[model samples]
Target: QRATNVGYTALRASMSAAEWLTSEKSVEITVATTTLDGEGQGADCALKIHRLKQPAKAQRASLTGYQPYPVRRGRRVADEAPKPDPANPNSWELGEVVAQDGFNTDAAGKATRTYQLPPGPYRALLTTQDRFGKEVTALLPLTVLDPKGKTLPLKVPNLVAAPKWSLEPGEDFVALWGTGYDEGRAFIEIEHRGKLVQAFWTEPGATQQTVRQTVTEAMRGGFTVRTTMVRENRAYLTARQVGVPWSNKQLSVAWEHFVSKLEPGQKETWTAVVTGPDAKKAVTEMVAALYDKSLDAYLPHYWTGGFGVFRYDSSSLTSQFENVVKQLRHLHGNWFTDYRDAHMVYRSFPEEIMANLWGYQYFGGYPDGKAHGLLPGMAGPPGKDGAAGPRGDKGEVHDMEARVGGERSSMRAMEAPAATAATVAPVTPAQTPDLSQVSARKNLNETAFFFPHLVSDAEGKVKLEFTMPEALTQWKFLGFAHDRDLRAGLLTGDVVTAKDLMVQPNPPRFLREGDVLEFTVKVTNQSATAQKGTVRLT
Candidate 1:
């Protein structure tokens, strides 16, 4: 049984080998046989054989993968990748393939695909291959948009003439004026360098706009004016550089009632007011130049200096040398007096003379025999000394002298009298009220109010009544309203709550023993008539 099993295994092995060989296009086999005689010597025979060649198997090619390039509407998209051609492996022709709904390939074995679709979400079914030549299908998401659809036209506000070149720190105001669309909102922003320093907004339906801002330290070096017009969720921006002025006293010109529109050849007179001390000075100078004959206010003239002599002339050298020597001599003389006082007046007033003049006296100075004696008539006879007056009484010392580590003595000579029973009164203790029963007043100093959503009635009016906080201050209120028709309105005002007399106190939050605190109070008088009052703090 084991021998039979071995024979079956060997047969299976031979069959497998034959099957493998037949699978190829061609196969070959060899056979050998030998016959032996009694003498142990025989002839050997060998046969060589060959199988007929089978037809070659057909090869099929498939797409590997593709790369996508950036796509835009109305623009050609060129995407290329390794080609998927088995038959034409050596082909180098590059081509672009357009698919109705599928991918394409080029002649150079590189896949080039182009997509032209409208604005929508789409999935592209791409056929590709893995490293093992296995086909792989990819699902790619695509979004397209129309290049011209839903395009909004930009409308910018036309700004007025530039503001003043320079402004005083706190006294000058920058006025910005412009014309804008009747609809939407307009914002004016002042920027120093590239940073926004201040901004102002204008309400809708205002065709003409004006805003004024005070010049501040942030606007010192220079600033730019940026205007933005917002409508339908879109903003259009425009900017202009108003150069920084080098002078603080620059003149300002303001035009009134300037005509914005006129027909061809039409004339409209506009009045411009020029202000500042510089403007007045300029006017004065102009008047003086026109009317004053002695004034040398003439236009400048240009002149060129030259030495007219031939370059090779011998005399030219001599003249040039002479000129150089003269210039050097003049320079040497100027150097001595450039920053030095060389005038005769300065020499005449020497240090000794100046000192003597500073201490000079017109009346009697020295004795008659001295080197510089007094003037003969200016001297007068010395009067005899007056008799001594009587002496005054000395002041008595009130403060006592301090002594270290000694018993202090009372300064008073007499002791205070003891209080009698009839003059003494019983002391009463302070009574504190129960905090639970005594309700505390609620603090009503509200600083802000927010009413985000307010609805109007049928009459297109909303009335709201709220108690004002107990804050004696000026309150600024800003509000806006919009209807379903897209119309809007804005409101701004200030309300002041005051009394004839007001008092504010500032006290220390906490105190420690031996600490001296300085308390202060403020008093205000807001009445029409003069008020006299006293402020006392305990």
Candidate 2:
């Protein structure tokens, strides 16, 4: 007997485990009792096992938080109308009844996948096979809505910048840099000449614009690789690629970017550390691989540094400057990413607390920063209870992370959702937790792909520069050695490269009857690609 209060997954008749436990098998049982029976005797127990009879049907799960899921059907045709012969991207062509899902045939030669439907008001039917080759048919219900409304529409996101992909001369390596190569609910797909190149997403909702894909020898010139981005839950879009030679200058070996403009007196030094030989983290491995000596870290992506909203003005700082800030902040002062800023400005606007909870430091005053022991400009962690009501601060946005060894990942990030109570067996694997792992900056690499010997200098050396409008070059204010050259070490240049980069289509952009939306792609290699040694196009 089991306690009724305990929760359990429902037992299903079709369960494979049922055949074993319910068969005439031997089962061992041991019971301990202090009570005796009839005529002054000891406790006794029986080793009894019973077969669980199969039920005629399985139980359905109760729906508690199920919301109105979006619905879609085959393009709806009015009673007086006739379905147009499929012509362009939006028109649902007479799908290959067998391969309509776009999924492939399994080993058993059967295609299967559930296709999405546009929200409401139509009816249709389809026959398809599950991956296991089991044939099945499903029905749809008809509801009334505007018959002329849009059907299932897909959109391609705008490319934030030109993608730069180049080959490591004489090596089978290619380094690509660009924006928006994330994965999950809202993900992006890289396609080359109307073909899928690769797909990536770090997490849901992070439309970041930096990714590197290792390619095989199968890659070649004359192919345009464009990023197709779409928000699975929302609608937002863009795509771009410029100057990719289809006939000549197919000779890119390395690619990178450097912001050419700097403020009056702000200085910076990039510190890079190759990942320790004994790194035990996946993030470390993946990030480190981006700078593999054989590959180039000259990525096509730029950090959205130099962008920030004014804390006091409460107004937007939406200029090229703001965009720069967003990129720089994303890199933080981390050794893992090739964060190069030639024109850094020194502003007295650090957060009062570090971005992490409990990280607080006092700076420039009677600064005995209390409560988490932080000063006025430390970052006090993000997503901190929205800093509402009493005892709150503005999301602690001003933290300083010196680039020494590794990137400091946010502790507050989206995680996999919890499973709700259910009777139906899960048809998919539960996602693994995406937790942040700490890393030291010195054990990572920032420019192995472009210049392996750039950081080959001696150790323990440091440098600092505090310039004024008059070009103040005094190191005493910051204190540092004289032999270090911060300029030669950073990844900076006026030009970058984009190989096999193309523009994806925008299908849902105000579609009317018989309209076509064109997606474009272009490729080019900047002069910077020539100075490097290794170059890979794959």
Best by lDDT: 1
List the pairs of residues colliding in candidate 1. 64-129, 83-109, 83-110
Positional deviation of 173 in candidate 2, in angstroms? 12
> 397-467, model 1: which lDDT tens digit per residue?
11123432122232222343432211112333343223345332343453434455655444333433334
Please, what is the whole-model Cα lDDT of each candidate in the order they appear? 0.35, 0.26
lDDT (Cα) of model 2: 0.26
- Candidate 2 lDDT, tens digit per residue, 1-538? 6334221221100100111111123211111221112111121111111112212222111123223333435575334423321221122222222212222233323222222323222223433333344443333322211222222111112223221434422223222222222332324445444565666643444333344445433343322333333333333333322222221111111112222233323343333322111321111100111122222335444322111221111112111211111223454564566768799778654443243323332222122222343334443322334432112234323223432212223222235343322222223344322223422123222322222122222322222122222121111010111112111111223311122222222333343443333322222333454321211111
Q: Under the 3 Å rule for N, CA and C atoms, how many clashes does model 2 have?
A: 82
RMSD of each: 50.8, 34.4
Global Cα lDDT for candidate 1: 0.35
